[model samples]
Target: MASLSVGVACVLLVLCMVVPSLAAVYTVGDTSGWTTGIDYSTWTEGKTFKVGDTLVFKYPTFHTVDEVSSSDYSTCTVGNAIRSDNSGSTTVTLKAAGTHYFICGVVGHCGNGMKLAVKVESSSSTTATTTTTNPDFSYSSSNRSSFAAYFITWVALIVILVINVSLWQEF
Candidate 1:
């Protein structure tokens, strides 16, 4: 009975520790034909995004999501870049707080105003709230945690079963 109690407590503790590191999914680009540029005209900017928020690009053409300076387009040559193809999706995790810029790397795309900007607010607060209500954008933080918990639970259950079977001389 004591061993069973310990096992239950261990399982609960593991689950508690693993539930919050999951990745959330967020959609970028416009679903409707109204927004013609790489900019997230269909989405909101300057929202609070946690560390695990995945920005999904749902555009119909190839585009690059690059972090750039807020005022100068010359600094656009720097920062991390993600190139997504048409009808394809790329999930990028927000690691820090700052304004992230995106543009179409295709020839003359950026020059033609195919650019978008996103301001990722700091995620230091434990209870940060987002200000956008766009249906195309969504976020979830339990993806990684849920997978980890499921994996751990299965492994533990298998190990426990094997041990019990061995003790009962059934193996």
Candidate 2:
């Protein structure tokens, strides 16, 4: 019935409103990626990192991504690394709120400024995320479909409500 369709549309509208937006994906070092000679500090400056955001490190086979402690990061020591990835294309998710340190495991790479230190927040503010666009980084293209679906669902809900109201008046 028309009433059933309206009810389903209303439910979809609520779901669209309640569901949190997808987390953002940031390309580390931008076009430079995780490599030597690049100023990782400058790249991360002024950028707000939050839990659930992803860091994609694209590099060559000779380099490696090593997650280390703050002390190890300062000393460029790979002996005590917490995690090491040599896949060249590494994706790391920010799972917790705190300072995270990453360095290149290859000798002298970290010393040459191939290291990064990011302070991630627990969660981003939900109030200002209706459109979910980050000024610092480009959003994922896949998220566009989600936003489009949300908009269509919202409009359908409004139309359904209007039709239901008019039908009520006729009875």
Candidate 3:
């Protein structure tokens, strides 16, 4: 019984660690206007951002997403600048946790209040499960989601076996 408890505990621990490391993707721009841009006035921060999360900047016009300081505009230090030239997509990974300020690097753009700010909080130790539902589950499609379900089932079986072994050890 002791062995079984240990095994189950290990399985649970592994699941607890693996689930949160799964990175999430966030959109910085959409059809209406630039998200996390000067025109938007403000950008969603903190909880919306994670350590390994990627911020995708998608905009049509020439704009820059620069990380700057909140206190001083002249102290503008660029951290991650995404120009519209890079295939219309720039992905930035959040590495550190703190309040980050950004703005357009275009001439006269930042001056016109094209600045944005965001606060990145430290990652939580607990893992949270993320569920994504496919509204259109096509039976004919050979997509990643279809395969993922099978993979998850297989993993679950392995976990169950581990738990059983641990339980048997207790006896």
lDDT of each: 0.52, 0.75, 0.52
Q: For candidate 3, lDDT tens digit of each residue in 7-59?
A: 76787787677655666655553454343334543446343665555555565
Error of 2 at 157 (Å): 16
Model 1 TM-score is: 0.53
Range of the 10 consecutive residues with the lowest summed lDDT in candidate 2:
130-139
Cα lDDT, model 1, residue 129: 41
Best by TM-score: 2
Sort all candidates by TM-score, best to worst.
Answer: 2, 1, 3
lDDT for 19 in candidate 3 is 59
TM-scores for all candidates?
0.53, 0.66, 0.49
Candidate 1 residue spans exceeding 4 A from truth: 29-42, 45-47, 72-88, 106-115, 126-171
Tens digit of per-residue lDDT, candidate 2, span 1-171:
576667777867766775545566678999988888899988988888887777888889899888888889999997677878777787777776777888999988999999998877768554223222211222233343456568677877777787788778879
Q: Score candidate 1 by lDDT.
A: 0.52
Candidate no. 2 TM-score: 0.66
- At residue 114, candidate 2 shows an lDDT of 92
Please provide, for model 1 over 35-119, each residue's C-alpha lDDT reduced to its tens digit, 9 standing for 90 to 100: 2453454365544456556566654445454434444343444333433334334445665555555555555665666666655
Error of 2 at 57 (Å): 0.7
Scored by Cα lDDT, where does model 3 land?
A: 0.52
